[model samples]
Target: MSPLKPAFFELAVRADARWDRFSRGVRRRMGLARPLRILPYRGYGTAERVLIQARVLEDRFVKPSHLRRSLVGSAIASYKRYATVEIPGARVAVHWGDKRWEGTTDDEGFLELWVAPPPGVRPGWNVVELELLEPEPQGVPIVSAQVLVAGPQAELGIISDIDDTVIVTGVTNPLKRAWALFLTEHRTRLPFEGVDAFYSALREGHGGLADNPIFYVSSSPWNLYEHLDEFLALHRIPNGPLLLRDWGLSRHGFAPGGGHGHKLEKIRGVLGTLETLPFILIGDSGQEDAEHYRTIVREYPGRVRCVYIRNVPSRAQRAVELERLAQEVREAGSQLVVVDDTVSAARHAAQAGWIRWQEVPRVQEHQQEDADARTVLDALGRKGS
Candidate 1:
């Protein structure tokens, strides 16, 4: 790691203090409050350009023992951190919650606002666009992250997939897939071996690294969320928004192209909602994730930082298509990562410096998640008994 330049670090420290003072002054004037301590990960995740998160505060909850009359409690709560930037003299309008909130940036180029979020709004991703005065301004982007109201920390966001990438099922086989889903409905789905610990490492942020927002987007239908949730829980996987394909019922049957289209639409929706914060995408080669991700890279350009693809056995024709798609993905500015298995993928991910080496703890821990998964598989053996 490179040593920080003393001069630059000093400047950063001073600037941070000034920003806080400015925020404090604005909050005082507005009759609101700012956080005294900046607690980490209870708030947001740090990506390449943006740090995004939800609102959380610390509180305590009690747990009861079934056999005993005693109750045990743990301290836990979440906070919501919402701060705004305003250009006082220079007029600016922010579009949020279907209505435009008007404000201007002050002399120090700061804005303060009190936002009451609308109902049904999930806490994962949101955008705040600045409605500028002029039509064609040179080189100034007009969007910022829509964050929480009072929290001093942030959580990192992770967007991933299922089917051959995280699990071993092929989504293309509708009947077989349905049957398999039925058999393993609430049981653990097959993890791609080391994925569980990789996920755990990301959540725990092994070293001084920050935690992130984790999402799962799949071509799977909305009907499968319960089962998918069960699978994740069984594997001890953490949670975020599970974006699913909503293939509406039709008299004849479900549309063939609906899943692909729904997946693309979900990707776009996720992008739009998370316009401020970028994310990492993980999927497999069994289907069109590469091609779809290539298109997303083209559309969003630099928003996509890294892509992890698990290479399943691809048909020759599909192999040719994936090769072409991989090239296109490279051209769009993100790298196309291909891995043989989850262990090798984690090794490559660490090698590429995407994830840290210390995250795995021990290679055997990876084997343990696999071993646990195998135990689940065996427990299912006597299902018909």
Candidate 2:
């Protein structure tokens, strides 16, 4: 069939009707169909023409490259989009309904597929995705969207932690940290079950970005800033501003009590910078996230919307401290919620109307599951176990 008309795949994005109009015009003019594209050439062909197959290459590793370059408007700006997901000896199949779209990746896993809606695809809430057929398991959440006929302009922000949050390397040891990152890309993260869904729900904005901001804050060193994007993308974690620690190595000199205080300072700076906007904070009980939130609540009072603390380790004294902090949070105006895992946090956020939840696979933790949740609580109380 001839190319599918742009109008056929035109779906409204929240809070961007005018921009959407312009976008649709551009898509029509440029014949941009699918926003979803892949890279890394598994099957061999000429540099330009590679076969689009449906299989995951285990030996094949996908790396980032500037292959598909295009220009926009008058500026001859180069497109520097890179593909990081490497499939060894594998290929992906982009299927819509029963129809299949054709494309393939070069050595860099770059697939030059037409960006068009599939045939027989209807309007409103359709599964637009590319499935990794070669790999094991028939169906997985590659990517999907709820296409709407009309929508509004929307923004998204992500609030998260630093150590053991997105990055597996806790602020403990350098060698262990390097091992964690090297073995598992950020995507290989073992986030609390259902976190992927929670993030997706926010990214999709079931409503609009006004309801969410794709911003994230962590107590990690600022040095890891460059790796965050790849890490988040690998794990399919949503994208957002990563609030990192500037103290300790580069610019900010290390203080007496390590960079813990430095991290809190960064969090405070983020709060002040985003003072005018309402936000949500997701963190672990590992560092001073809760304490920082307490400060934020005390300072801004009604500015913060919700606070979710991932239960970790602390003493009885710290537990008492948290209780006091919780009281402060409540008084300042936001809710202080504690959950065992990230998945639970997402649910609580949904139930509490703090955030809209999305569907994701459950993550099973064999080791942490056996550990005592209260052991950390004891540490919080200062009564060392």
Candidate 3:
């Protein structure tokens, strides 16, 4: 914890970034790297201005659509994600309506462009076009990222975690988590029963006509962005922005501050961007989620309507800690709800009038149907063992 240690770590990180940038340039110039491609992430923003994020990288990773089902295949694809070949210092431009903004990718090959939205832009989802200006490709690859803009009628926003909150990752056990993450396809994983229905009901909102947007903030690396998006769609979960972390080491140290610091920072970004719209923060008790939510509640005051913590297997001390957070958040004028399953969350939302009571039956039905599916998923995980 010495000051010198932190200074030394910062120097190491900077050195690593510089080396990576240099080697990547060499690979590209020598025709050793794969074709440079643009990967644009779905972003969330307000009507006045929108925040867009994209990355430039060598397109060497195997496509999820073309991947075969095998431990080796999955492992290879996962390796490609982590062993990223970023194209740093690429000039980029974003266009919205008649407005245009220019930027250059940072040391991590990430570009964050803030551009004004087209005047009189409708809510819901909108698109912004982007293209590489420097280090141009053969055909000038242009891509679009989906930006979720809540309409005036939108009263609330939902920010949920990914790992155990949305899907089964066995995040508490490092081995099992790796098996689930690196050795299985998106279809092979199991979501909590009734999760889709529950989230859909929440998306329906209190007579909002499906305008309430959902933002998924996860510690999962951006390399898995496509797989995660596919999983969400495969499960019929409502789609929105996928806010994932960069796995590479940076100023925040290894793995982009891992779980706690990253999630809170992203949550703050969403709140700050949306301004007036309140939020419902969703995560699981598998880690320090409740603790993080408690901090968010205190920092934001009454801005958070509630914090939903899905119950995951944890040490007894963790349970006691969550119970304490429940009371702490309550005193902050928001509830830190601990739900055992998706059904529990749906029932609570129904009684709280966030969702209609009639939606309860559908959620229950999905829970029962998904019950058997859980066994098959567990078996798949065991096979990896």
What is the number of backbone collisions in each predicted candidate, taken in the order shown? 44, 58, 0
Give lDDT per model, in order: 0.54, 0.47, 0.83
How far is each candidate from the true structure, as Cα RMSD in Å? Answer: 18.1, 18.2, 2.1
What candidate 3 gets wrong by more than 4 Å, as runs, is 5-10, 208-210, 256-259, 377-385
Best by TM-score, which number? 3
Per-residue lDDT of 176-209 in model 3, one digit per residue for the tens? 8778777788877878888898888888887737
List the candidates' TM-scores in order: 0.56, 0.48, 0.93
TM-score, structure 3 vs. true:
0.93
- Ordered from best to worst lDDT, the candidate numbers read 3, 1, 2
Candidate 1 has an lDDT of 0.54
Worst 10 residues of 3 by lDDT: 250-259
Candidate 1 lDDT over residue span 133-166, tens digit each: 4212233345454442211122334568787667
Q: What is the Å distance of residue 287 in model 2 from its true position?
A: 1.0
Best by lDDT: 3
Worst 10 residues of 1 by lDDT: 73-82
The runs of at least 3 residues in candidate 2 whose Cα sits more than 4 Å from the true structure, single-residue gaps closed, are 1-157, 170-178, 181-189, 204-211, 247-252, 255-257, 273-275, 314-317, 357-385
Candidate that beats the other on lDDT, 1 or 3, i.e. the better one: 3
